[model samples]
Target chain A: MAIEVRIPTILRSYTGGAKVVEGSGDTLNDLLTDLDSRHAGLRGRLVTEAGALHRFVNVYVNDEDVRFLGALDAKLSDGDSVTILPAVAGGAFGFAAAAAIAQHNTAAGRRTPVTVG
Target chain B: MLSIDRSIVDAIVAHARRDHPDEACGVVAGPVGSDQPTRHIPMDNAARSMTFYEFDSMEQLRVWREMDDRDEEPIVIYHSHTATEAYPSRTDVSFAGEPGAHYLLVSTREPDTEEIRSFRIVDGVVTEEPVRILDAGVDPHAVQSYMFGQSPATVDYECSGR
Candidate 1:
């Protein structure tokens, strides 16, 4: 079962700058494992140490997000197109800082921290 | 350095202003390997939070696929900071995944003046870069300070309310 995977710009290095690469597998995990064989360290970026999909990495089987389709356990078939995209997210403050500030503000009985102008 | 059109910068600033309490995010796509930013695609902030911004997953997929089909890449990834300075915060540094694209930040903290800055974030390292905004229809090589010197009588581009 050959599946075509689209690589994002950030992960292109692992695929030798190729935009698309092919791999084989019956499930998403197996597909990543198959890809890791050819693209060393690629799986590490997509999957965390606990074997779960990285929080900031988004994987889609065709047009559907894999998270909605059993994530890493999602089934795969021949000619399936898998696309990997890094979740584009960030905030004005670090999580710890934001939490601390919120706690301090709450203790002071002040309104929530002003985030916007 | 991120050399982009002045109109595009205005559009970004306008979008940021319109979404004052919430951060606005978007991407500028250009031909592959060409650093020039030509298309401005304003994206929905899925988080819809005052301090954070995230591109909607489904919308991101569609936009990314469109860029891929057009043989283009995200040359500039921009977002607004509602109450902070126009600089990458620790959160931004940690979550930056587009090493090849310019990370443009617009600050709407001040009602009178908006601050804009650009940076290159790679491997958790943030390096500030100079932004050269080129005037529409003007030669890019010409040294014209459209942003600082004076405002154009008429804007050639319209900011889409996407």
Candidate 2:
């Protein structure tokens, strides 16, 4: 059950700059546990304290996304390859100001100020 | 290096222009293990933001499953930068999971100028590469390796009309 797990650049520090590492487990979660034992704190970045996979992390087994399979419980075996990547978010620009202004204008046009009845 | 048809490149740029003011993202799938990108798939940007792009989770699943059924894989993943240069941002590199895929960026910041670039993102490293746009009657397989000192694609590309 020696599976090859590819490490992402941001998380390679835990793996000592190793791009790929070998682990043994029947399930994906188990594989992470096996890897954490050797790598130390590798699993924390991928999984949350509540035991769920971290929201910003994506795990794939053999190129098939684990979320579509069974997430952390996805089955695994020897020769399977696991890849972990962080969720990409954020950039420049703002839609909030325009959206708020539009909403305000629409409200002002749709209703008139009424005195207390 | 990656070789793509001129028509395909045009289609990608067109999509970027059509989605101006909002980021666009999609993929070009090829036969599994072939590494020849041919199929064009324009996907909706889940974020719908000018500065960011995200593949809708459900749409991503459906597209991936469809590709799997067709014995294909995403050989090229593309996105648009509405106001930025055609380069992968830190977020893009952080999310790159396909080591064998070519990452393409198209910038539609200028109305008259569209800057398209290709990159290889593996393990968070972004390396720009030459994109050979094949003209009519020029086979991607037969095109001369115009990229100086760059290795040719591993698989030969045939006209696999969709």
Q: Write the per-residue lDDT of candidate 2 for residues A66-91, one digit (tens) a residue.
A: 88888989999899988776443323
- How high is the CA lDDT of each candidate model? 0.81, 0.72
lDDT of 1 by residue, B75-98 (tens): 999999999888888888878998
Query: Where is the poorest 10-residue window by lDDT in model 1 chain B?
Result: B142-151
* lDDT string, candidate 1, A1-117, tens digits: 589999987899999999899999999999999999999999999998999998777899999999999999999999999999988888796756654665676689765333322
Give the alpha carbon lDDT tens digit for every residue of B1-162 in model 2. Answer: 788777566667767776777777788888888867777788777666667676765566567668767888788899988888777777677667677788888877777777777888877787888777776733454322222121222222322222
Q: How accurate is candidate 1 locally (lDDT)?
A: 0.81
| Cα error of candidate 2 at position A80, Å | 18
